[model samples]
Target: MEGFDFEKIEKWWVARVKDFFIGKPFKIKMDLSKSVRTLVRGVLSQAERRQKDAGGTAYVGAVMQHLVGAKLELFLDEALEHNGFSVADAPTKRNGDFQIENVVIHVTQTPTESLIQKCVDNLSSNLSPLIVTSHKGAISAENLADAENIADRIDVLEIEQFIATNILEISRFARESRKVTVEQLVEKYNAIIAAHETDPSLSLIIG
Candidate 1:
């Protein structure tokens, strides 16, 4: 009993909890006929379903965040720094989730008033704030920006289109190339999840 390794047991228990929180990699079918935005939404919808199944432990935010990170890495042709899902911007002193050039990108499933304030803060620092969220969250972000009197300064976009448009451009607007583009994105997304997240279930699988 004196040599009991409580810390090791605690780590093992936490890992098990995270595994249950995100049960499996959601399977998404790739179809050339489907618009890239539609495909992206399908992925997010699967994340939503998994979250609900987990009794609302909230993994959608992480899914969206990492997807955005993956897309940016591929589209921008550079590696971006990745942080774990639960890490807050304030603690990390990050301008946003990802920053490139003068643009500060914030990815979230739910847009809050605090986020609006962060956008304002970014503006004061002469950096453009781009908010990437779900379609409904985009509306909420816009409304929040208006309430804070910074609607024009902050750009709010749905993550589906944000990721989709880049994929189209990266694939050179060709249909066949789009599939390859998506496959690359999935691979990058899975790699990011492996490196930055403890939950392997957050990894996505393509069918």
Candidate 2:
């Protein structure tokens, strides 16, 4: 049947749907200790599974971005605010996935030439540019920036490395038992999203 594996794909979707439904109805408080444990487990599990499937790199990349974004929103926002900074989700028309103060973070599964150009555009607009891509894509991103003669102006970081640096406790707990439930993780994530909804600092208005 050519490159098709209907049965395997079906099973994958079924498992994902089941997990979604099973984890949908529960709620928990925003306990950073417990939530970080759950987030680490979930991100690793999802990344491992995605990396093994066809076109898995793209899937893993998207998942990594979401996970990273969640961590930034839930855990790092307070610290940013404390330091007189804030992060906001960038709109599609924006150059990056997130705006952290005057810096724009462009997250990609792979750092293609187009994405690099976007970073350059951000730089021209007087916004600092940060590229976050898969570990394998980090080198390419850096090279592209160099080619564009903007390497010194932009920063490239591997997604995993960023997580490790910003969420050291979670990285350490990734090896431990899964003490937190998926339901709790979802609740914590939702809390972060809800908080952002009314956060004036997160607002991005463009004329």
Best by lDDT: 1
TM-score for all models, in order of appearance: 0.88, 0.56
State the lDDT of candidate 1 residue by residue for 1-207, as single tens digits: 688899999988977876665676776689888888888888888888778766786788998999999999999888999999899999899999999999999999999988988999999999999999988999999999999999988889989889999999999999989999999999999999999999888898987
Error of 2 at 24 (Å): 12
* lDDT (Cα) of model 1: 0.90
Backbone clash numbers for all candidates listed: 0, 0
Highest TM-score model number: 1
Please give the lDDT score at residue 101 for candidate 1: 93
lDDT of 2 by residue, 1-207 (tens): 799899999998987875554333222233455544354444545545545543333434444555456657545544222111123233336657777888988777678898888887898899999987766788999888899999999988876667545554544455333233323234444444345433222211111
Candidate 1 — which residues are off by over 4 angstroms?
Answer: 1-22
lDDT of model 2, residue 29: 32
Return model 2's CA RMSD, one decimal.
10.3
lDDT of each: 0.90, 0.57
